[model samples]
Target: MKTKLWFLLGTLALLLTGCQSKNNSGSAQQLNLMQTSDLLSLDTSQHADLPTWNTLENSMEGLYRADKHNQPQAAMATKVVQPTNQGKTYTFSLRKNAKWSNGEPVVAQDFVTAWRRSVSSKAQSGYNYIFSGIQNADAISKGQKAPRKLGVKALDKHTLQVQLEHPMPYFNKMMVMPAFFPQNRTALKKFKSHYGTQSKYLYYNGPFKVTKWTGDNDSWVLMRNKYYYDKKQIHLNKIKYLVVKDANTAHELFSQNKLDDATITGVTAKELQGSKNLIHEKKAGNYYLRVNVRNNQPLANAKMRQAINLAIDRQALTKNILADGSLPASTYTAKDLSIDPTTKKDFAQETTPQQTYNVKQARTLWDEGRQEANLPKKLTLKVLGDDQTITKNVAEFLQDELQHNLPGVKVQIRNVPDKTASSETRSGQFNLSQTLWLADFADPISFMGILNSDNPQNYGKYHDDQFDQLYQKAILDSSNNQQAYWQTLRQMQARLNESMPVIPLYQMVESHLVNPKLQGVLRHPVGEDDYTRAYLK
Candidate 1:
């Protein structure tokens, strides 16, 4: 009996030790995620993609950030401002307690420096057009004026004022974008050309600070900022991200418990439909095809563009190819992104149907286009897209469908790196390219503005006077004309589709496998992921 009791006590001690070991192993307070793509730049003005913006949003904050209910809430600022002087002037008061990771006070001058550089012509910022409503922004972007002349000023250490060229009703929401983020002037001057190019060159005022990204590295770390204004509420110690472009690899990592969040695409999304970890969110964005008309003989023909658009079976792509809950976009702007001020109806649902999948119609249009352009029936066009799994799947699908539907046209699918694809598309180096745009703010104009003639992002070189005029009129109407505003949006969308400069493919839906134990991770379909309050339960 004595021997048995001693043995039992030894067994109990071993069991307790094993249990404690397991608990300690599982208690890591880090959130591991798969990054969307390579983070191109830390400078907010230098890049326009979601990955870069999301990185900036994580490490640095703007005046406002989206809350739990996806509504804009204050970040650096204490409150939202109402524009004075009949909506032409806006003023803000800063939070005195906000400080950068280095313990420097975050003041109003930081905002002034960021806005001027972002709108300057030297930055080649894709979003400079967004600042057109700000006073002297257009002139500054044109190099006709200097950054000092910009209408933003720091009234004091805490007070900031802005003068707008026009009365913009939605200007408050625009503050959420990274372009409005304040950059540390001392840091910028210290790093010179090296600033925002590497993780070490930047400072953080948000919940986290970036590290280990040496300009072009695929992996990085977002460590919790001790100096963060709300650091006391932050639960996670660190957020680590790895650039796993392959969906299979990402899913495998998640299955092995190596990653807390993993994005899945193609058949993977379908197979994981009922899985406990599966999560899907409809995106506020659209993927479209831009055809370069310059030096591209076939693209100049409107009939050719129409034929290409008709050949695409968007419904089949969204439903069959991508089993995710993506929408078949008839218009360029996404659903639920914009609403009529008065009617409160979604603008995406109200636009007229622009294109359709008609094999017979596509073939007829192709023949007509061949004759119209006085060219041979055989046409060879190269299309550039990302080399990742889902994008490759889509490119192959389009190549097969377009060739089979349209007679004698062969599309060579060029798989390039994400950055290469973006540069080539913007420079008009390819015959056709697939690209996507997420709204910087909740505005239909954010989507449509990229297609304008003078817009630098207009890679297709499409120009229409009627569309521009109607769009301008809609933008100028700040008196809450819901009926006129929505109707004008419809007309603008109709004009783009009629011109056939680009073909609207489908809206996006992202699939993720999130750890059930992780709570308050704050996943957004657009800008910035909020992780300050996120905790491992």
Candidate 2:
């Protein structure tokens, strides 16, 4: 079955809300943090990366926001509003006290405007597909219907109502996503194409406001928003982020005590183990290789793809090379997140399984793949990834493993900047793309959506109609019958193991540095930080 668009999340943010860190270091009100890449776009509808989303979650207030437990909590709205129309329709009572950093009142109309603009024909919104669950959103995005027909409506200034085409179980969690964040039409129209192009073009309504981002600046600051409804709960006066592309550089900053937090990996991770300031958790995502089987490439042969998946040593990569809390990922969806409805047992522990690792079987498959592609005995393929230190090391390690395990195969590693790497994969310019997907919401369906045949996020174009049908069946069945839904999900994963379009490598245990003095940074596997409640001890 075709899945939905998958969002690639790189590093999970390290917030100091509930972390049990020792206080050996000095305290500071402002937390100096380091992030790997520069912000791509602040526009929620266009930006897809984790860094941008994290920034948006801080600067913009959605109808709901994520809590310390990664559950949806009220932010703009008064509470987690339940649905009507058999779990398809929802009415939100927005907090009248909420206002933008620019001093404009946040109303239901803002959400209406943003939702409509995101689905409109000319919006060029990359994330519009996320709105498909809402009524008429699919039609509006397809241009089959007008934006006005969208399910969202403003009953009055403070009240908003939404009607979904179907009962979307994850709608509550999705409300916290950036796409669901409200946008002022006045600002959108005033800025036009330059909207969110620069920091000044956008308006902030959450815990912080953007100040020093010139759109292309490598560094920016988030200052406390006085107009925010819950500003009293916000502790930090200023949160500064500098884009340090290299992990070693970030590590150096951490060593020098220049940054309060830094995400360390590779050799640096191995060295920092058992530190009092380190509070690590199993990250909620998987690293996988997306084989572009298009253009008659050797990977187009299922045997070739299977050979590649079989050859990799995931255990060594996670333990030796990564040296982080990351574990070998047998499947794309991380274990422990999704449980079987019938057995109430962990999904991965119970039913889903990974393909075996055997060089001999891999070689045999490789030979068959060459024959299937009607190719010569020898072939060369390029593997693509970002230029991050860990990314390059992983790519190199894979190159060595694939070349060593499978004969007649020469592998080349193509490392580019983080931004360009994603663009190249989406544009179909690479043979193999190193990809990752953190569950957009806390569910198996969130991760499964990436494997859909025609999904925009499926850059590899791995299509299986049977899987797509089963996936849709799961989504539909989930509302009425939970048992049937879990069974269907299990079947879908089984089909994935057979298909082997995307080879899962690991489910990373998130690693990071925290200020010993920084207290109460709540650790979440997904969307893992809430600096609003963070305080310097």
Best by lDDT: 1
Off by over 4 Å in 1: 1-28, 295-297, 341-344
Angstrom error of the Cα, residue 46, model 2: value is: 1.1
Q: RMSD of model 2, in Å?
A: 10.2
CA deviation > 4 Å runs, candidate 2: 1-28, 120-125
What's the TM for model 2?
0.92
> Positional deviation of 437 in candidate 2, in angstroms?
0.5
lDDT of 2 by residue, 352-373 (tens): 5645678889999989888978
RMSD of each: 5.5, 10.2
